[model samples]
Target: MDQAALRTLIGQLADDLGWLEQHARTQPLHVAQAAELHYAGALVRNVVGPFLEGHAALPLHVAVVGGAGAGKSTIANMLCGAVLAESNPQAGFTRHPVAYAPASGAVNWPSSLGFLGTMQRLSKPEPSSLDADVYQVRRVSEEAGQFGVLDKFLVWDCPDMTTWAATGYVPRLLEVTALADVIVFVASDERYNDEVPTQFLRLLLRSGKMVVVSLMKMREADAPAFVAHFQREVLDKMPARAVATLTVPHLTPAQVVDPCRNAPVYRVPIVNQIFVLGEPVQAARQRTVRSATSYLMSHQQHLLGVARDDLLALEGWRQRVREGQMEFDNRYRREFLTTERFRRFDEALVRLLELLELPGVGRFASLTMDVLRWPYTWTKKLFASAFARPEASSMPERQVLENGLAGWIDHLRKEAASQTGKHPLWEHVQHGFSAGLGNTIKDRFNESFRGFQLSLGDEVERTARKIYEDLEKNPLALNAIRGGKFTAEVTTILVSGGAILYSGGLALPFVAASLAMAPLSASVIQMLTEFFGSQYVDFHREQTRARQQALVAQHISTPMADWLTSWPTTGGSAYERLQSILGRFPHNLQQMEAAVQAAMM
Candidate 1:
């Protein structure tokens, strides 16, 4: 990736993660992971981007970080060898981060690089400032720093992490922490093992910044045991990172007032640790950059952990949709498929009979067969007219379909509306149903139904055409069927005529004889019927039924089911937007890693 592309990716990744952080829910898991994502993006923007782009690291800055009243400002004063930072006794005193530049020279830290992320870098500290979006750069007085150990280093007096009041300003502290080359963790004896402070220490360690743990304000007698206890409880429990631990013994009033009088004895270990850990400035920044980048890359899934709930909800929604779709299909089968006579296939059967009528030389025989078949046709009419036909269905096919679709959507709406404690996807689905999910689905189904109708009708015609084509292809089968029909017709005519003549043309004798012959002629005709029309007609009718089922499922059920099932993740829905944003992260991390590797090379 080129510089421009890398920058764009960085900006995009940061912006996406920032959005996740902002819209995070009230659950502790969401809030925790969201905060992690925020820090990851912030580190990418503030530290790794600059490090890869060859933007110089902020001049060896040391940020003092800890919980409320953990003596962060006191530690900052020690690092500065002066009383520049306000040593407020009250907890959560520091609201915004303050940068203390060495007063001996004009020190300028670039504010345009987005290191502070829209935070105003003030010219002086605001001891009483409540704003979290801004930080200040104050020049430390020359006289306060007699010890020149940290003179070249810019120090930060950052806000606390453990207090509820520190919630808003936590990002400010994180910004300063990312900008700093070395972190001076000032954990007092009282709150060394506090959840937030210890978590902050562990985070700083993982971020790959040089850390010097300051175990401060301990009684001299208890300092050794306390330092050891803090080590076992806090630093020892952290992921393997080489961090220096030191103690700032509870000082006298005079010693507190003038920390530099004894040459700021507490500053030596911290300063020495920083120098020893961050000897080569470029290497130090590079390490921090590599670690921060690795942290982001490794924890990318955790960063997306916020969406786990949404994804599960989406799957649940899809399952319900599939169930509803099954019900829709079942309803369609019951209401429409079973009763459908598909009269078009009957027309096809008639056309097939026309195809079987051999033209030209066979016309005379066909005429004779038609005359003989009058008896059978008359009998069918007599029986059919004797009984009432089944009543025509009360509902049309389209109405059945419309009602089924409406019912499917109503099921989904009820399911969504009744669901509790699910991901926000349920709420979104409920809103979708309210906003006309039924109507939209019906519109789509109607469109598909149009195509389905065309296809189904065409299928019946094709199947009917196929039967005639098959018999036509086999001349033997065609001749056999015509011969059978002729035999049956000749038998019926001969039998009836013989019976009339044998009875001497008497009406009673003729009637009894023809009635006795009725069964035999009818049976022969039934056999001929199998070979001629009924077989092909019955087979094609069934084939058309199968074709209709397929058409309805393919064009109507499948499309509608697929569309409705995936609707939650479409059209700018919440899950749709979330996955879109989530999709960018892996690629962004890959590109950044590539760019960072190239830059290093």
Candidate 2:
């Protein structure tokens, strides 16, 4: 792969990992996953990128790592054959890694582009307690050509792994460790079996770095037994094929002299182990690359768990959206659809009868029917005027729809507010809804409702007109049928009025009056059936009702429901970002993994 393209891919992966780290929930497991993801990205940008660029691996990096007060600085000093690092007595003393380059100048330090990702190299030395995201480099001075023993090597003394302050500088440690071709795991007798450093050592071995264990501050007589136990407890579970273990007896102050001249004498076995491993720099670097690649391939699922955490949060949001939709649907059914009578349907029926009149004699037929039905129409009108009951007003469709939307938003807001601390998704939703989301939904619903209302009248008229157009094909039969409807209308009014009088006003008067008119209406509808030779009138009415119901859904219910369902995934929303991160990060990681495989091949 092209170096520039690789860098771009690695850079993007790092950015995505950074975003995940920042936005993932604050749970301990989630934080640990984020940290792991961040470390993986750093490895790509720093270790893998430089390797692919064909940068010289002559200056092999060896990082000394261990838990707090595990004698890591002393081990680093021993490796360099000099007092390159300050081995203080305080636990967790080193906050950042300090690199010591050999004075021989046989190999140049890595360029700023890919060495320690994101950590600026300090020009002047700062205190080990200066907790910051930076690293310091110091050149080891030659004493009688003594430092030349480990020429062409860069040794890093890393901060403690098991400390409260370690969290602040652990990323610095991971950075240098990822760059190392060899890892000198310095474990004291007290810290050897400790979980924190042991896990770190496992990770280093799993990543394919050559490791040399230095069991420090143990009695000379007990060294053999201690080393045996360390091997069985720690090394047995490691993935590395071979790991060199050296037992460092409790040394006097004089024995901790300059490692350049005294390393071969005092730490002869450890010094010889380093020389044997450091001789094959090219092979060692290749082994590191191969090990890192294998670790990544095998651990891809672990990396994807980070993405899954965000996806799980998104799924929770979707579940809430589904619940909110159910609420909206239920509210709409109860508050609006069930109570709506569609009074305009009556007007459509009357218009249908007028259209049934003979095409050329429409006006004459209408007038004739009017004269015949005048008595019944007049009597019914008088009774209706006298006994009409006022309807109890209820909320309009617009208000009902708006309220349903508001209620749904309120539900989500309350849920989010209640659970904000539990997950990042809820907190994000709470903030979004608080910032005009409800108003936005209402505005969208109003727009759709107005459009629905505007088209409703035309839809009803068209349906009614279709019924007449079908009937017009048999105008002669339809006209005669229409004439008989007058007689039916008169008979219906008389019989229905007598029945109402017999019933003694038991029903609401308006309802009784409507009931009285039903037979006439049924008679006219029967003529329509006769003319059309089918259930045309009933079907048309059913079709019109269905259309109106659909309009209610399309114009009002659907928009609001969709808005609620999709609110979390809207543009610029946290859920949207999480989805993007989940999708892009994994794809990029797989691509980088494949690239690593190709580079190793």
Candidate 3:
């Protein structure tokens, strides 16, 4: 790739890398894969970030990363004008990453704009010491800055991964590796091809990180063959997708320690120039980034599918709950409202009203007459008999309703259980808890009904009882209590006829007296009877309505509410919400298949 095209590609890679970093932060898995993917993202960002910016600058970031006393610090020194990194024999001496930038301020260092993610900017200058795994930017001395045309190259002194502390610091190692366009994976001739470095190399290859491997302390004669063997044995084993590989020649201690004494500018031939003067090897870098991006996109659905599957499973649960709700509605309507017990309730109210007006015991004149009347008596009797109390046949008692509700709840629990399958939250709901659900729901329903129904029925029933008691106390003992005035014309006709038939002119008065008294008494009784019958009809109608309301309030609504309330608590969490959608799926597929067949027609 030409420079501008390379820059554009770098920008694209950096943008993609940023997306991956955010994804990693938000969607970290419980396993090692999350960390590894995050590390890969970091790797891509670091290498590509610099190229995206319009700097003619190409600062190859070469990291000398390995275990303690494995010549990492020495390699760092060799790359940075001799012994810049402390070559302490003590393990874990270098705790952090150090950057040696070219001292000459001729070409400015590129701002870390496109550096994968945000980089920590350090204010301190010149061979600055850093905490482990953190990188510090320091200017390279003027004498050691000869290799590059533009002067912004830096060598990083990374921590030794073999140390106990390195596990925590590996992220820092990865961060430096990601930013480094050229990573100098430093290992001694002895430490080369170990598992840690090998693993790191695999990671770099996956992230498309370029590698300039340095095998330190090797004899000159063995170096070339050793490089070839290492390439075949180690590099070839990696996915054939690595960007580039470079092997640094081994250096003597004398060549590593002093920069000015050696004829070679840094006296460390392989490391100093490879790290400071390395370029992108643009074609290879592009190829690597492309492959890595392709792999990431290929597996994109895998990550997103986790959330999708969870939603689908949850929806499945919802559908089952909805079906259960429908079942409950059907059962409640059929089994309770249309029940014999409810019909009996209507009959009972009628009977209680009938009890008020007995056959012989009308204390009130009006009631006495009414009870004696055939029409009034038969109407009340017909009402009581036709809608008579049930023969206790399937008539649910209070206990039965409770049990039914409880059983219904149990059924719901079973349905929920059956529907949940292996869901994580299913065990929270068990059948025994259905009792509590039934009770709570039923009680709430009862409480609501009690607010309106119970008091009204009690008052109406109380009034009816009082009226019955009063009528019984004051029976019609005198004819004056009844109203003969109601049938005065009939009385006159009867008296006149009796007088004409039974008495001559002399006995007419006597006949009239007997006829008038009997006829008037009968007329008074008949009037009273008519009045009582009408009152009884009105009272019976009222009682029937009251009883019907009481039954509904007491039995049906409360139980239904209770059952519905238990649904969510019993492992059917919001399950009903998705019922329609899920239920329609099989049908929807069928429709689609039918449509396809039709199209084929």
Candidate 4:
């Protein structure tokens, strides 16, 4: 596939998994998987797709991500080398991100399709509103270009990931996280060791992102020990492509308000590190894309674990269907097809032998045929005649079919009841039986059985007619029969004092030999005719039984089996869609992974 098709697929798969995670009914959500799914979608939608679409990687992103009240906004302002970020005392006050582009050389920050996912871009500043899924872009100037790193950067003052409000905007947080070429992780002394922030840091590092950690609001004396502890606790235990840490002492109120002049400690090194991390903007962006997608590719199974569970449930249903089909077929063969006697074959044989008579002597030939059939006709006539009457017999085909269908349902019901709570399929089947799956199938079977009888009768008539016509239309067979009659006449002629070699004997020795061979030839012709007619009858009998089986399979068994097999997917239910979602996710995810990885290469 070309790049456009690849992009479409990647976008579609990202949407699919994201939708499944959000909507599909399934087992309990794995909290880590849920979060990772969002992050993974953010990676594909904001980073990989845009990169593959030839979006330029310039004015690289740096997100300020930390916990609530961790001085994220203050840190963002200081990083701007001036007060561009909103500094609010309310914890998690920054509900949406505010992008601070460098006034010096900030163009091509990010188009809506580039890095912003489902978020709407605001033309003007409105970071305090908690209602919209939006982010704003603002340009902040450096006095005399003191912190020139801002020239090639778009710093995002993002929302806190620790507050209750964080849940609502976590997707927005992830979008920034994936878009950034660098992460400026600022942990206030109180929030540094917290589990939520620490776990978030681990995720960022494991993606091979370049992270610069700033220990915010600490004493000059405590900075050394805290930095060492933060490294041991976070950096050492974490994974990363690059990590650099610095300490920021408690700033004066004047310094906290003014970014460039009074907050030199916070402003200088933070800028220097981000600048160094994002120096070659192209390389930095590529590294971020590779790391994020690699993380997505590696953790897909874990991310799609809930979907996998749904798939397993569907597979379990399929297995039960197969087992039920086997039971149904086995019962049919055992109870009906194995012992069923076809009376049509005997009728067809009677008709076939009647064809051996010469024209205008069918009456005499049929009588002769009746007498000959007495000696070598089917020995199973007793059994076949019993079925032919339909009054004195074993279980009929209809009863066998009804019983087989009932047994099939019973087996499925028992199986479903066995694992009642294990999956939705069982529950569905359990309820389906209660709602009359059996009766529905029986009603359909009644309709099909009527059709089956009509079709089978027609087929048998055709078979018998074909048998009768074959020998009648054959000249060789007709001539043989005529010669048999002629031989019989000749034998009588010689016995009555006449020549008998087909009624002509020139000498007495010839007449004697003809007399002996006459009876043998007549007997041989009658035996051969009976022999071949019997074989044809038996062949047709087997075919008729097979045809019966096929009718049962097609008109009865197959339709029922198909309906039962597809029961789970028929209803417009969440689990039905869940099957579809699970089916599409794995292969599409693998393709998306391969496509992005190949594009990266």
Q: Each candidate: how many clashes?
A: 0, 3, 15, 0
Q: Which predicted model would earn the best lDDT?
A: 1
Q: Candidate 3: global Cα-lDDT? A: 0.52
User: What's model 1's lDDT at 315?
Assistant: 78
In order, what lDDT does every prediction score? 0.75, 0.72, 0.52, 0.74
**True-structure lDDT of candidate 2:** 0.72
TM-score of 1: 0.83
Question: Relative to the unseen true structure, what is the C-alpha lDDT of residue 341 in candidate 4, on a scale of 0 to 100?
Answer: 56
- Candidate order by lDDT, decreasing, is 1, 4, 2, 3
Error of 3 at 500 (Å): 63
Question: 1-601 in candidate 4: lDDT tens per residue?
Answer: 6876876777776776676557533445455566766777777777877777777888688899999988887777766767767788888888887788766663674342435667887877665545478988887656734553567777788888888768888778888887888898889888788888888888888777788888888888899999888888777787663377888878888887776677676688888888888867788877877787777767777776756656677778778777877787778777766666556667878787666565565567545534434533454366567676443355787888788878887888888899898866688878888998778877877897898787777776677677777767897977686667545644543554544634465577776775555444445556676688799788877787677778777877787777777777778866767667667766776776677667667
Q: For candidate 2, lDDT tens digit of each residue in 435-507?
A: 8777787788778878888978677567756665665778776777766664565566667677777767777
Q: What is candidate 1's lDDT per residue for 1-601, written digit by digit as tens?
A: 5667767777788788787786575445587666676677678778777766677654777888888888888777777777778888888888888877766666644432455666776654566456658887777667766553456578788888877777788888878887777788888877778887777777778767778888888898998899788777777888756477888888888877866555357767776777776667777767777878788888788788888777777778788888887888888778877787667666766666666565678888676665545676677779889896885674698898888888888888788878855556777777776788777887888799899887766676677677778878998988787676666666776787787777776689667768557455754565466455767677777767676777778989888878877788799766676778877778888888888877777
Clashing pairs in 1: none
Better of 1 and 2 by TM-score: 1
Q: Between candidates 2 and 3, which one is better according to lDDT?
A: 2
Which ranges in model 1 have alpha carbons more than 4 Å from their true place? 26-29, 104-114, 123-125, 128-132, 141-152, 261-265, 350-394, 451-457, 469-539, 570-573
TM-score of each: 0.83, 0.75, 0.47, 0.72
